[model samples]
Target chain A: MIRRGLLFVIIVAALALAPPATAERLIVSLSTHRVLINSNFTGTELVLFGAIELADPDILDRRGYDVVVTVRGPQRNFITRRKAQVLGIWINAESREFVEVPAYLAVSSNRPFAEIAETEFLRRSRIGIDYNILTQRIGTDIADVVPQDPFRVGFVRVMRAEGMFSETPNGVTFLSSTHFRTTVPIPGSAPTGTYEVETLLIANGALVTRETTAVEVVKQGFEALVAQAARDQRLAYGLLTALLALLTGLFASLVFRRD
Target chain B: MRRLERRRPFGPERAHVSIYLPIAELPVNLFVILGLGIAVGFISGMFGVGGGFLMTPLLILTGVPPAVAVASVPSNMAANSMSGTISYWRKRLVDIALGLVLLSGGVVGTAAGVWVFGVLRRAGQLDLAVSLSYVVLLGIVGSLMLTESVRAILRAQRGEPPVVRRPGTHAWFHGLPLKLRFRQSRIYVSAMPVTAIGFAVGFLGALIGVGGGFMLIPALIYLMRVPTTVAIGTSLLLVLVTNLIATVLHAVENRTVDAVLAFTLMIGGVVGAQFGARAGQAMRAEQLRLLLALLVLAVGVRVGVDLITRPADPFSVVATETFQ
Candidate 1:
């Protein structure tokens, strides 16, 4: 009985000390791959269901896991301006141009990002809205700044107010030992584009595996046709609009005849 | 602190009644916009003006982008003035020959104005320019009209006949060359002054989204010595044509006009204009002028206060461009 106990202890220690034979793999599926923005679109929520497949069942029975889901919309450039009192009137004084930044960015996790991992690790991985690099052009220089940078903070604050940039703790919920789910919000003003949804699986404060999926937001129906016409056939569109206004005026004159 | 509250979806509370403007890319309350249109239309119809100066500022206040508000007002002006132009034409009050001469100058000025508008927009100074122009123009015109109308009322109370126009008197521009006779206006004037006046009206109309009726009518009567009826008719015709041109130019150049929004405003405008015309006939002209002057001054003062005061937030943001 003593020899058997020793052998069990050694085996358990070996298993614990050795590197994971196979990393945990992530499989995720979104509720919908396409979000259609019609005249009635007033923002929506997308459900993401994920499962963790363990390669070695005996690796860890504690089932302590963490998840951070990030949804990033198409990238675009932005300009942020600071107003100053000029000649006794407020006007835009200094401006910063942010290049190639996500127009919509939402980072959600099961718990606070700081509780899940070290700040350096989080920054390195770009795991939160604050960690994501927001490139800016300042005079002749083009680079991202520290998290506390004023321009960066202003840009993020404006975007957050517009509901385009957000961070939600406890957004991810674990359904079981191996299953998890989250609801990603798409604001009403969310730009129409291919949004990339990235799910990271962390175990013991280290990233184990990740998976990526995509969702498309598109302008559909009459709204789409109008925007398309305005872009593709600008002259015809303009002339038509002018003609419509003129006809409406003439029609009103005929209907409300005076003398 | 880590857990942030999400924005409430423009749901439940604003559902059903909100309409999505494809170009503006925002949802606005339908009834509110319609009511605004009707209100502005009523004032325009009663005053025999295009009402764009009021409409553009109001649209901006209601959260439409300045570009969209400025670009869209021309179409509404064109529509509003067309009905008035038709009635004036039927009465033979319009001086077509003079109108054509003015239009020749107006087209050039409008083209220049649209170009300047584009440049200002790129520089992000359009809002300031719009506000500053409104304050200066409205302040001067409003004060002038207020004094003139008040003087006329006082003269009537003193039992004095209204001052008569002295035809022999001529302004400095009258001595210029290129003299033309306007049979409808019953005046012989230099085409130079007429064209210059048209250019000014067109520039103001395109840049500030106003019909220039208030300035044009007064200039015609006081400067050109045209009959009051003919001046009103001619000015309405000019506003119609110039606004039509401005609308097309803005749409083609900026692509900022929102058709859905314009249509809503137009429907409300036409209906309210009919009633406003009736109300206008009931009021005396001097009293109406005084009221309009006060309204103009009020708007000017409101915009001026906004400029001088500190804004709620010191930072503003704009997307550089759309990806597609």
Candidate 2:
């Protein structure tokens, strides 16, 4: 009887704290917020469930509703080099540096991004990867170029090939009039960092509401300790590694001694 | 619902035993690495060689990045040489004085090689440098060994007596200044020549992840006129010390040494080497040398082909701070 009373009080409190119904509000939840990368870690998928809290309960206008989910991993600089044949041998020649781009990016939407919003709005809001600005350093100039630029195209293509960047139309599926979910794939080579997951609610070619959540990918256990030691105490780590090599060698010799 | 799981060569279900390499930051099949270690160990034991030259290339073929593969080799070398060094030391064949002089020079050479490795990596020419070096070194050594073995075989078939070299022949290098007496080797040689040899061996070891035994043994025997037993023991000692230092340098400078990977390879290699050693004793020395030569040539040719051929994709992408 006391447990039932407490549950009722929590529901009343949630209703009391909720915003007054004025515009559509987004409620999102991730299957997991922490991804531990340890031994035996291959890759993993995360599910994101979201629901639209509407002002009116009776009217169902799901036909006009759209959802787009963007998951972006930590940003890092990368260099895309194009090889040229120099003296009958291929070597890296021309290079372009992409400054502060998402290391991993996945864009998922209920339908194609173009149909959900105007081109101008999409670019302004950074709804899609192409629409997102990626600055590059070309010799002296540092600015974003056209989406179709060769270097930009090549960078995206290479990242996509490595399973670091992806885009899937109709990735988000609506379970009911107001509920939807999508899957986010974290590849084996994914860098450990805080990943931001943004969910956008689009209605009539304009975003009505949006929500952002965070997921942390971390190296745990022995993997974490080793990486940490290598980075932080490098000299000591080096010495220890050498010592370990000596010990392992000596141990093997002792174990397999013929005399 | 749209399925977003991209097509991978092996799904999670397909890979039952996988281990994450802390430095490489990738999960690799444990069994595959172990099996490779065993195969290389077997070959190394049968041939009485370090096997690092074979191990590094095989690791690269198994999808390990070249930098990691190169750096991780030193630790494995250190382990592989330890047993031989210990055994040789017990027999009192090692020239400790000579080994120390070589090590002094080796340290400097290793430092220089590590710096060169960093520079080449930054220039995006490390892979090219590595491949080119392998082609040149392996090709020369392989052909030399092959011809020597073939000649020996022909001589035996003709029922000819083996030519034996007279001991105590002084070389031009022996007249140089700063001569040092190595009691075990029973020779007083100029420190400069000995140090120079060590420098070359150490430099190659650091750059290409090899023990340089093939070069050292021949140089010691032919150039320095050291006795075969002493040369072998001293060479073993040099390989052990240089590799230990190389591992330290690689870890400190390039930060490319993966201890986990090294340990895994060592585990398999040590066990496999024992069986291979037994099998090697049953085979004729000339036949064994020929087989090793062919294996070396094959690997060299394979690397050379990759260098000459045009890559399918002209564009490559790397993080600004990718592994060296």
Candidate 3:
């Protein structure tokens, strides 16, 4: 009995002193392609699809986090040239947290090619390409990168693609790729740690390859502690109130009658 | 000590007032409630029906608690029925004895209905039952009315007489004992049928949140063979009494009635009742019955369809928790 008690004490001490294990990371692949064009090519547009996967085994243990993707490229030229154009930007994933299971990326487009591009190009092509090209290309390349910071994990890349060439007064005829990249900063309130990161190369609106690296985010002061409490509290209250009011009103109406 | 005093914002003395006026102090959604009242009142007056059947369902659909919807409907119906009943009485059309007898049964039926409502609600079957009943009853009634009305119109256009003769009198009614004299109806009939009808109307009114005017008027005219003029007046009188009782019951039991909501609906109903009474004067008895029957059938079908297609969602959100 004495030996067992001593062993328990040692185990508790070790657990208290040891650093918390890092949460598993998730990698999402997003892809976009432009296939249709109208005369003037200015209206020609691209579509995007995204997919998500667990990067580390431990990712399944951690709470899910939202994913946001922004694709930025020359908007004006693409619209006028009847060329595949990346307009303002596309955020395939909005505010959604997912577990370790694979999730299909929401696929969408700005507008139909016929509607946006010049009428002539639209008449030429009837077939539309799959929207998942970009997600597949980038997601596959970045799957290996582990997040060094348990709280922070993300990647961005610039991709260029060229294909069946066509020209217009506004731009060159060669099907060209649009490139952009972003690095998201984990706020101080985020979990303290380092995270694995990955880089993706995309061509013809598809993720072609990837590069992996480590990202570090150091812990900071009191502000982080306060910020986290505020966020969690606010989310909890908002969801609770809206759901409650809607339900109570419905049930009460059904159950009681004056007569 | 000062800090402790500051922390306790409300003193113990203030607690009772807070409980009594909990909802009273809260901001009311007056516009939405008033709009619903006006629409329901207009329909009720124009159609010469209490409109509770439609109003109660409409209130629920718009997110009012079911208890509140049921509780408030009778009060609203009372206001409208009062105005209409008074006008009919002035015109010397009311059959007071027949109306009183029906009302007696209606009151008892209403009490029983309310009790059953409680039971079904606890068992979680109320919504499905109500919806199914609405659809089935309305579909049958509406089709029959529509068919009868169309036939009447066609016959009239072809220069046929308005009244159709029956071969036999109401012999079964004569056999019933405990006869009562209804001066306005100018007949002596057993009090049993009148009381039974009253009870049925009362119970249905409480369960379905209606005044039972539509049902009562038809029963008086067809089942009792009362004249059309007396039937209308008697039905309206019965509606007034039954609705008054329902309103009182709701107030005492559930405390669900929103006085402000009831007031708003009453205003609309009052105005609509005047116009409705005027229009009713011009319509033939058969025409009016046909129209009312069609309305009932329509409402019934709607309720029934809702039950069959998608029973009420059992898991509903309530008071910061989800309950089934």
Candidate 4:
């Protein structure tokens, strides 16, 4: 009777932490284009625009879930727009090749698609600079870019969704979704940095989510760095050599003293 | 965390871990150190040599730094030498005057040797020179000693008395001006040879980081024609004085002495010496010579092989501008 009671308690705890039976599906997509502006603009400017759709539309504004878009390069920042109108541009403190812009929308609204699109929807975010005047900006050169084969940009969706398996009696497995797309920049003699693509999700023509991802640029090869360090610390090498010599002598003295 | 709780305080963490302690806390490892001291001490008592040639290397192998190993050698020798010399002195075996003269010459030679050492260090050639010299000198000496001892052994086995013939080289000593009498050696010789030998041994001792006892004992016995017993006693006396001086010099210049390590070895040496002395009493002089010769030869061959093999890297390379 006591053993049965203990087993029942364990089973009850496991069932309480188990994930919900239904899973929410999310879809994400990205697009890219070069906006050719006047010759006076010396840099590349990036703008991220995208849409997201959720099958279970009511779960959009869950407290623990977030959607973010990022743009990255050697020196890049973010500019956001709300209601199809420009909001403000902010200096990107964490400027690498990628910068992230994030947006969140609550799920409780029940409105028509046309009404949602007309009601001051978010639009027109710019990453690097204004698209109309691009050439005057100090951007990366064409020849000095890192290979894009290993570089990547992507989005990940983390949900509070959970699940249970019999083998893991005390643990619950959570559900997550990810989507990514990246393009390699042409290598040229330009200042090196990260370049990226960013996107926002639109559900029923209303802004619902955003995400950021990147491609990297680098300068020197790996082996070159090691060779440079060796050249710089020659004295340390010499000292190591001398210590070895002394060790050899001592070993010799020990072995051959009885000649 | 559970394993950490099982560790005991003041226990051997590893076979050769270095332990640091204030002087007051030294007694923890004193027993093992005392044992090493006794072993080397007994060797000193028996052979009347400082045993520094062996001690310095052993200390280094036991994880003491080279500079500290070299510097601590003299102090260790002094302790062993003092104990051995006292016993010999009690037997009325030491020649005080002869030992004093050798000590005086050793002091002067050591100064010169230290200067040469400094110059070689600056030139970045000291490591190579010292190692090569150790191999050359010890190999030759050890081989000669071994051969002589072997011959003596063979003669004894054949039940023949060993022959001793005086070398016909008295002409070399005739012209030297200052003549001195050494009652123990029973010779009236010019001070030049004694002084020269002292200087040579002193230089070698400094360079090799030994107490010069091995060199001094052999030179006294074979060249000066001192009796074996007298040579042993006088050698110990000279070593005691010379090593004391060297220890002081090393302390002043390099501050390389590690008192803890020295004390540990000395502890072992002292206990070992008592047993070694007892063992020595049972052995014949020929047997002792044979053993010493074999030991030295083994050391020499080891050193020589290293020197002849591929060139080795140096321990330190301080950059300096060369005019040329």
Best by lDDT: 1
Best by DockQ: 1
Q: Give the per-residue Cα lDDT of candidate 1 at A229.
A: 79
User: Per-prediction TM-score, please?
Assistant: 0.90, 0.89, 0.50, 0.50
In angstroms, give how far residue A187 of model 4 lies from its true place: 47
Q: Is candidate 1 or candidate 3 better by lDDT?
A: 1
Cα error, residue B280 of model 3, in Å, equals 3.7
Per-residue lDDT of candidate 4, residues B66-179 (tens digit): 444565666677666666676677788899888878877888887666666556544444444565566677777777778888898999999999743354446566468999
Tell me the tens digit of each residue's lDDT in model 1 across B186-246: 9999998899889988888888777788788778877899987898889889998888888
Clash count per candidate: 0, 0, 58, 86
Per-residue C-alpha lDDT of model 2 across residues A76-157, encoded as one tens digit per residue: 8887777677787666777788898888999999999898889998898788879877889977998999999988887888
Q: Please state the CAPRI-style docking class of candidate 3.
A: incorrect
**What's the lDDT of the predicted structure labeled candidate 1?**
0.82
lDDT of 1 by residue, A146-230 (tens): 9898878888987888778999989999999789999998877678789999999887788888899999998899878877877
Per-residue CA lDDT of model 4 for A23-55, tens digit only, reads 333343333343222111122323232333445
Give the true-contact fraction for every prediction, in order: 0.59, 0.67, 0.00, 0.00
Tell me the DockQ of each model, to 2 decimals: 0.45, 0.41, 0.01, 0.01
- Superposing every Cα of model 3 onto the true structure, what RMSD results? 21.3
| The TM-score obtained for chain B of candidate 4 when compared with the true chain B | 0.83
Which ranges in model 1 have alpha carbons more than 4 Å from their true place? A1-22, A55-63, B1-12, B164-166
